[model samples]
Target: MKPKKKSLSDLGGIMYSTDPSFVYEEENEIPEQALPNQQQDLRVMLDKKNRGGKAVTLVTGFRGSDEALEKLGKMLKTKCGVGGAAKDGEVMIQGDFRDKVVDLLQKEGFKVKKSGG
Candidate 1:
């Protein structure tokens, strides 16, 4: 099977007549002083979900990309010698690693706060 050919205007004319660099220029114009502090900006939560009769700990409230979360997750897992995954901006460790995670984030200069039971 093959897809049909369409012009730049086919997608609601978003791609056509729009200078791609326009957005980039606007984004790059923001000064560093305008950016929020990392310590006060991020939120950490522990969510428990019942999957297949097993409880899973979901650590969320990160304000970065998948790459950042993945890197942090890898480091945390390696440091703790455990298993986990970084998905959708959340880090899921196989066990209760809240304290360990907080410590690691603190060491990395992140302002972290534990929320929820």
Candidate 2:
């Protein structure tokens, strides 16, 4: 029987392998089923709360990332020339822009859902 290969520790206790095909580590890959849950996407919703008597459109269902909401808020504010804010994974635009916002978000390939009274 042949002797087993021994690994060597280089400087500062770093390990090295003579084999070129050896990989020390691999990336953390997420499962396919968890992809949707882990997706950094957003879903839009219409909200009607104490919006200072103004009709506010609420965008929600974001997968934990606020980047899209922030960007969308900016775009909507600029496009509609209205004011809006992104908070708690949701964006609130100051107006009843459900139809227009839905169209814009759909055009950008986002699954938007409107909800309100």
Candidate 3:
């Protein structure tokens, strides 16, 4: 494959224009992390659609940073005594721990509901 072109952001520098009116200043600022919405409810369920008949506990409707999601996933995995992965704003636990996860999330101030059988 041919080498792809890089954008200004990929280059990591500010743009400059020949015109005196145009100027670019590089501002390195980290955005404030978003807090999870209390009004919004999270869903926990079991999914086995594409895993060759293996069930995975899925926690969705998480509205926060990936780090926060991973933290929650890690906590759940620890509590359930199992292993899993967290990514793409969703947490996946290796087994069926719907009730356990729901209880845990409720304790953590998350409005969680069991979805799907």
Computed on alpha carbons, the lDDT of every model, listed in order, comes to 0.61, 0.63, 0.81
Q: Which candidate is the best by TM-score?
A: 3
Point out where model 2 deviates above 4 Å. 1-45
Give lDDT tens digits, candidate 3, residues 1-117.
112238877545655567888655545656445566565478999999999999999998887666777888899999999999988768999989899999999988889999998
Total clashing pairs in model 1: 0
Cα lDDT, model 1, residue 56:
41
Residue-wise lDDT of candidate 2 within 1-117, one digit each (tens)? 111235443232446688989766633544223123234355555565675666777776654334654776788777777899976656788887888888877776676666655
TM-score winner between candidates 1 and 2: 1
Question: What is the C-alpha local distance difference test score of candidate 2?
Answer: 0.63
TM-score, candidate 3, is 0.69
Backbone clashes for every candidate come to 0, 0, 0
lDDT of 1 by residue, 4-114 (tens): 237754444455346646542112232223222264344555555664544344566565545666887798789878887887657777766678778777778778777
Ranking by TM-score: 3, 1, 2
- Find the 10 residues in a row with the least total lDDT in model 1: 25-34
